[model samples]
Target: MYPSSLFQALLLSATLVPNVFAQSSTTTDPTQRAELALSALQIWYNAGSGLWNTCGWWNSANVMTMVSNLAKHDSGNAQLVNLATRIFANTIVQAPAKNPQPGVESQSATKRSNGNETYDLFNSTGKESGYYKMIGEDAEPITIFPKDWDKAEYIDVKNLPIMQPKEQVTTVAASNPNDWLDGFYDDDLWWALGWIGAYDVTKDTQYLTLAEGIFKAVTKAWPTACGNGGIWWSWQKDYMNAIANELFLSTAAHLANRVQDSDKAFYVDWAKRELDWFTNSGMINERGTINDGLTNDCKNNNRTTWSYNQGVILGGLVELNKASPDATYLPLAARIAKAAISELSDSDGVMHDACGPLCGGDASQFKGIFARNLQILHDAAPDAAYVKSIQANAGSIWDNNRDEGNMLSINWAGPFIAPANASTHSSSMDALVAAISVN
Candidate 1:
């Protein structure tokens, strides 16, 4: 439920660790270093599907956008343009429409403490349980490319029929638009971010309009009911949390900076209102880091600040600074970035979330979001240490987390410990591609 490319793991890094970016600045050319790391990750792209071999709709959406962003910046790869073209074609046509296929569905009717947050979506056995694919999904089967694809298990798809959409109703999430929001506000935001990235690369008015349209509709749900002015975690409106609101603020601010003349002011006003309300809302706890959300009574809920929660907001703040040019926004972003890097990472300095390895689809996408935003922060603020952190993460990803098939594990800390999925792979790809921006 987060940033699109991760748009997930990019949160805080400048505070805890020493200047990793600053130190790395003296090494080989920053672009070259980034190119090498990025080149390693290129193996994951699938020509057949016009997507990264990432399996799920949300993950593939992120991978496509991340690849697009990288292609835009990486001068070494002229071919990335062609790849982005192929990928976008696939993304649009394959996008799940209103109704879903037989036996594939979302389970929004299930009761829970937090809508879609309390339980794991699928069975570990990866089998079906009727009316639901896996327990966590609010609906039926979506397509999931398996981990084997990363290992060159089926390379022929790159040339011929691009990977066919294999309907995976067993343990996947919903795919269609009607229920795409499926009570999870953050999921919608994640998809919107992907569209935003697509818009960024193509200059296609349609992509920007699509993202802006989602933001327009989503903001309608920002109820002021709880004294806490934040987006609800789910469409069910049962809970309000950090990631969703952070995504909301950043996304609105980003769209404000990008949209055409008529819509700009509306998004800007929304961004400002959200930032002012959020900063004073007590979600950014005493730790100088953000907590999950307010309690039902509107007190600080004190939930663990997952890496993604910390990661997503920086982009909003940076864009807001550009829009309004206020001195305060960058400092706020810098302070949080410091806290995230120092506090949220593992011993090796790779970013991680509060969820650990058991983190399913949503959490799987966290760290990459952190990495991408961290680079953004660094670019705007000139935090060289952030580059060091990015470099460290790139090295660790290759050394400890990547598998024989080149798929990345969920934990950057290592052991290939969990079920390797597209979410994890794309999140790592975010960090890897981000290596180019810094030294």
Candidate 2:
């Protein structure tokens, strides 16, 4: 579970999703791009494991949508049918019979408080006994850390548990189903993406059924905090959880459109409200470098801009663009995309995993966000500037991050730790695919 070939291969979709030269009356050349994207997708499907490299689950869903919709266009990527089917089967098998436990809540759960909107599940050291290994062979509580992996002294596994007041736990506010809703959100995003892709591919309603089930779970678990209904920053409010709101908003919109059901208005409205809350309160400084979370707001905790947060929001805005075509969402997305291109890079051409007063994480964390930014830039503004930017960054990411060892190292591992960093790598992967298809 070191590095995944899946992302490296599937990234071809980034190149294909944006339509640089499509005219109002002309059909785009989806065949060559589809082939290129599928070629990369095929590599991932064959190589991914049930764990560590489970992006096979996500990427497969995307490819299925692609084939189902684009197949009629030049019979796109016929070989992907078998591969997507198998990956779907594997995803079903890999899904836990029950959701994994997030981890033991903080040792001393505080009583609720007024105007106290967040909490922490892990201590400041970022240490815990939760299982995070993709192997899924051992049954330990899932938390920031898994039990049976190599440990470094610098990597503190057993430390104090951090908790905000009990009120901060809003997903299953009355009852705790699991901690942080980590992989479950991934489930939500992918299910909706699969539904849309399926519709575009086959116009089959059954895929809608699958997608609806996912939406139901997501809505049931959606958080209501900060005077807005949104997902938390993380299990621990101190680290980063608010970004989940952005992921949820876009996912909810996709559901609303895909189902065409008036019943989901609450979910869609909730998404919009949270988006507003985030943009109004969470953004820090004039640069539009959105804070990681509330703590990041006061120049504490993670005082930097995270790629995943921006990526998920950008992805959400694109969906919002499709839903309403308003400047409110699109302009904000464009501004952040430009800021990311400028603020996150350095003289050595290395991307800081995060940017701000307090920023520290692995180099890999930045790759998905950077890729996603390039992707959205191309999708939203497909001129030479956007295309050149995407191509340039894509080359750098592919050259620097990819490893032949395993897709887990490059793709899976980063996404596995998405919550801690305030990025939605797993979800962003789906958006990256969506961006590619447009091209």
Candidate 3:
């Protein structure tokens, strides 16, 4: 059972009665909710011209997925389809390198011909500091020349035989952990769900096949790429992240239930164990402000709330609720949602400005995650008061975050297209679809 004090705090902060919506049985109005989310996506698409072109990451795919899903629900909106197609057309598929010829002459010629090319696949470009170039891939370099270098050292194939210089290492060392976490799985998880969500509305099994293949790859990559259980926080070789585990578990559960794969049960159980540990370990306070995802085995350490943790785990719990139907779990989740919107969310609908130091310096920075979670909650619980509150607040927040170009930052304004863009969960889009779903 959850602490009553925490429940009371949630209500008190919101200036409302405890579980006020619980007294009423109606789910949220799906159409109005979807329309609000759709408007956010439309804003993103109109502004994110550069993001749409440099694809393969969440930026383009996310918005595209939302736009496509919206088209299914509001068929009268012809522009949504056009925007989705445009985003898809801008994606990049990196070509795999072909094997070099076996002949010594060909090898020698190949070496000599390529001798002028100084960039190493594993080394840093100093342009996009943390990103490494693929040796044989067609990645365009912004700073290949010595003059173009940002006062950073460039290692040539001839001189740096043993190791790349410290300057190069520092550039990578200074890379942000959060950005690494964002790209760690590439598109495997999102693509799979993207296919599933698309299939649900379109009756097309191709999306299902895409999802299956992506899940298979994600499972295979678990141990190393994401550290044993796909639980690492920032793609760092050193630290293991609890948030990543939460997301992986949630994604794994979704896939497992959809396909009825027993192997996924292992992942699901691991997630439950971790989540149980988190709740008991005080990652969740009595007030229901969930600590940002944990570091493995570092109890009595610093843990602060991030909007992603509160919302994403709740989403996972919703899926778990569907599978198991525990009455207590949903109420617990509802209570947690209450804390999220009241305590963590700002009066204007952004999240995590109240976090302590362990939550990191940038904790107050990400408004998008909060918006996405609000979207998640609307889908899961659909409380009228919460819906009305979020819709009013979110519109202003969305408008505030919009840049002159109208496109928002992934870290800042991502929620408008988050369901489609951020994680490929089609969360925003799925929420829209769920709104339209009559069952």
Task: Name the TM-score of candidate 3.
Answer: 0.53
- When sorted by TM-score, best at the front, the candidate numbers are 1, 2, 3
Off by over 4 Å in 2: 1-75, 97-99, 102-111, 115-129, 132-145, 148-225, 234-242, 296-302, 346-366, 397-439
Ranking by lDDT: 1, 2, 3
Task: In model 3, state the lDDT of residue 5.
Answer: 39
Best by lDDT: 1
TM-scores of the candidates in the order shown: 0.73, 0.59, 0.53
**Per-residue CA lDDT of candidate 1, range 1-439, in tens?**
2113321111111111234344333434444333333333444444434344545445666666676767677634544544454455445544533111222223333333333233213212222222111213421112333334323222322333432343211121222343334334565677678777866666676667667766765775565335536676654455567877888998898888898778788988889988888887789988789887777667777777777778889988998888778989999998998898999877778777766665766567778888898888888998866887888886777667765545577878787764566678778778877876664
Model 1 misplaced regions, further than 4 Å: 1-55, 98-181
In candidate 3, what are the lDDT values of residues 1-439, reduced to their tens digit? 1222333323322221123334212324555444444433332221212232122333333444454556566665444433333333221111001001111111111111122332111122223223221111221111121232222121211122122222221111111112212223432344444445444444444444555554444343233222123433322223334445555555655555565465556546644654564455445667776665344444423454556556656666766666555676667777877787787645554333443211221232233334444455567677764565455443433343333222232322233332223222223234334335331
**Is 1 or 3 the stronger prediction by lDDT?**
1
The TM-score between candidate 2 and the true structure equals 0.59
Candidate 2 residues 273-340, lDDT tens each?
65776665545447865555554343223344666556667767777666656767777777776676
Off by over 4 Å in 3: 1-56, 59-61, 68-129, 132-203, 216-230, 234-237, 260-282, 295-297, 300-304, 348-366, 398-439
Clashes of 3: 7
**Pairwise TM-score winner, candidates 2 and 3:** 2
